[model samples]
Target: MADTGDNSKTELVQELNGLLADHFALYTKAKNFHWHITGPRFRDLHLLFDEQAIEIRDQIDVIGERVRKNNMTTLTSIGSVAKHTQVKDQDSATLAPDDMVKELRDDNANMVARLKGMKELAEKAGDNATDGLLDDWTDMAEERVWFLSSFLK
Candidate 1:
């Protein structure tokens, strides 16, 4: 691929791909927790998790499209996701409600960090469109972290 005058284009795309992978992992884990959570707050947590998962899924699609806009193919398959994702995977087993909330809080915090990093990369690469997108994504992830943290308290 020819350089678009900015040498950071490739690196920026790679970072965006990582963000996409993290969102994928987080979305699956949120769905897992949604399915397995039980206890006093079952209904509330279940609904929250499902909503968060859908939002994360939508973010993943936006990110993949961004990659395409940057002229790179999006990552595909679980293997590719695993390679790029920095979010930790959870066992496919039931978890206590508090534990599920805690895990998601930490993961969302991590996602916020990743989004910030991507935002910086996009700025450095002069990719204003991606930088703008990251602003919305980072705000959403930060809200998830806050809500999950509050729930655990």
Candidate 2:
């Protein structure tokens, strides 16, 4: 049997790790778009992507702090994040502005799904703090997806 304290902490750590991985992956993808996007939408997309990347980075710190609060180590390496994240890195070099928007929309949707799953896990584990954190992330991701999808319509 697992000790109660450690078990709860472990659960929180696992959820946090997954959240952190998603955040990092999103960050990379956003930066990729920011650096590679071109065409008529270049100016707007470049600034938007930069803003979005910053938002993801902010969430990363929040997730890392949550892990630390749970008395667990945070995963900080690219390899570790890649291994844990469900988000896929894209080949940005070949993508057009519309493609970039579509990719980000898909990524935001993926993140929303992941955060919802994490929220359920947090609730089951009685981790309100984590649930609250995920709630914020879910809202932001949904908003981002909406904005990105609008560009393609």
Candidate 3:
């Protein structure tokens, strides 16, 4: 890959790390909801949450590696993840099942927006690999949002 110049590379790295942090935060939120979900829809909601959590978890390493592939360090700790993440944490486990679905739906929609932002940065930097990966990730987040939205209706 050709160098996209230092400034472009640095900006791409920052955006990518922000994305990685969001993946971590959202993944943890999904798992937390999975574990705490209860009520008549417990089985369905639990499974859905777990599946979404796994999808997000699977992307974490890929996103982090993209940062490394760009010759930069990725996020190193929970504090750093918190610092960079735009996704808000759902620390209280008391949310109703419908609320859980709503929160996750909204968060996944936010992920799509974040992914699109990263894709634009990647494209501007001429980072084809990152740009392509972000497209797939954006698709995944959109699908998750679709599935979660169905539960709300």
Residues 1-153, model 2: lDDT tens digits? 122554655765786798799889989999999999889889999999999999889888888988887667989688999988878889658698998888889989988887887766676667788888788889999999988987888
**Per-residue CA lDDT of candidate 3, range 26-130, in tens?**
999999999999899999999999999999999999999999988899999999999999999899889999999999999999889888878768877889999
In candidate 3, how many Å is residue 77 off?
Answer: 0.4
Q: What ranking emerges by TM-score with the best candidate at the front?
A: 3, 1, 2
Q: List all candidate RMSDs to the true structure.
A: 1.7, 2.5, 1.0
lDDT of 3 at 51: 97
- Which residue segments of model 2 deviate by more than 4 Å? 1-9
Worst 10 residues of 1 by lDDT: 1-10
Model 2: C-alpha RMSD to truth?
2.5
lDDT of 1 at 40: 84
Q: Of the candidates numbered 1 and 3, which has the greater TM-score value? A: 3
lDDT string, candidate 1, 46-140, tens digits: 99999999999988889999999988887989999999998899985777888889999999998888888777778777888999998999999
Q: In candidate 3, what residue range of length 10 has the lowest lDDT sum?
A: 1-10
By summed lDDT, the worst window of 10 consecutive residues in model 2 runs over 1-10
Output the number of the lDDT-best candidate.
3
TM-score of each: 0.94, 0.91, 0.97
